[model samples]
Target: MLKYKLVSRANPRKRNEKQFYAQLTGVQTIKRCDFLSLLEKRSSMSSADVKSFLDALEFELMHRLANGISIRLGDLGSFRATIRSVGAVNKKDYDQRKYIKGVNVRFRPSAKWMREKSKTGELISFETVGKA
Candidate 1:
């Protein structure tokens, strides 16, 4: 389970007001090989086969993203290509090389992972790993 600790912080708008918030703690990184092994255990394919498939998936995903295509991975959500750039006053004055800073990939989580609450307090949906 994901672990977290309660941290007390003063409210930005009110210095005297303070509240406790859950903060992630003791986080650990799972390496590629470990991740492949976990996948291998869940599926019939071996870790090497899983790695090969993932490599191909990465290549194809990058190619499609580079071509300005957005991809949706079901419950995991969608990924799209994005660019960071400075605004130009006019189209004629805009220079792609100068105005465009860089290209980046953006990921949006699925609705299942998002928190939802109704005004009437009728329904609320969320996921919690519990406090640390």
Candidate 2:
């Protein structure tokens, strides 16, 4: 049986406006160690111990990513730099649109994850679908 739940926050704009919003919900597991139990033998450790270790590891990762360094987790993924816009753009200067100040963050994922995903199915052409 799956012990953990997948949780997420709703997009504020979608609330109470659509039927799908009711269906869309986030279910996060109680803690990371709860997930760790699935991959390894954890009979010796308590949940609190596992949680503390995982939390420390996550903090270290965020620290490294903030310094423009990528953290590679085996069989998971790699975290790399990404840019985001900060300030508002002036409508008159179209040429300046490409230049925007932003921050850096790391992304993590490994090839094994991709391989597992590929076995699910092949992509279908959008045109093949009939209109409702």
Candidate 3:
């Protein structure tokens, strides 16, 4: 479930007019240990083994993304690196190393995550919990 609140802001051009929008409220967070425990129960692996695997996975993902490679985790999803840059007048004058203003990580969810699982008992259910 998601929680949201109605927020109001004054227009920059017309300060007399106020605009309203929905803002996400407090969201619950889960810890890495929780995932480790879940993996241990779902698979034949121990919590320590799952933790080690996860640690290695994190390191490898960072290493691969730094090298300009996107990773596809099959049913999970894919992760890639992106950059925000200031524009240049000409392509020949553009410098990637200097023009890249910021770097960001992008995650694209898999098909299962992007849609309902049909009759496979895979479905998403959510309810709003009012405001924060």
lDDT of 2 by residue, 1-132 (tens): 212323344557886443221122233556455586642364566666666777788898878877778888887789876767655467566443565566666564577766664444332111212221
Model 1 misplacement above 4 A = 1-27, 113-132
Question: lDDT of all predictions, in order shown?
Answer: 0.82, 0.57, 0.82
Cα TM-score of candidate 2: 0.46
User: What's each prediction's clash count?
Assistant: 0, 16, 0
Which of candidates 2 and 3 reaches a greater TM-score? 3
User: Order of all candidates by lDDT, from best down to worst?
Assistant: 3, 1, 2
Count clashing residue pairs in model 2.
16
| Residue pairs clashing, model 3 | none
Error of 3 at 43 (Å): 1.7
- Ranked by TM-score from best down, the candidates are 3, 1, 2
For model 3, residues 6-36, the per-residue Cα lDDT tens digits are 7778888899999876776787888988978
**Candidate 1 per-residue lDDT over residues 46-116, each given as its tens digit:** 77899999899899899999999999887678999999999999999999999999999999977754533
lDDT of 1 at 29: 97
In candidate 3, residue 33 scores what lDDT? 88
Score every model by TM-score.
Answer: 0.68, 0.46, 0.70
Worst 10 residues of 2 by lDDT: 123-132
Lowest lDDT 10-residue stretch of candidate 1: 117-126
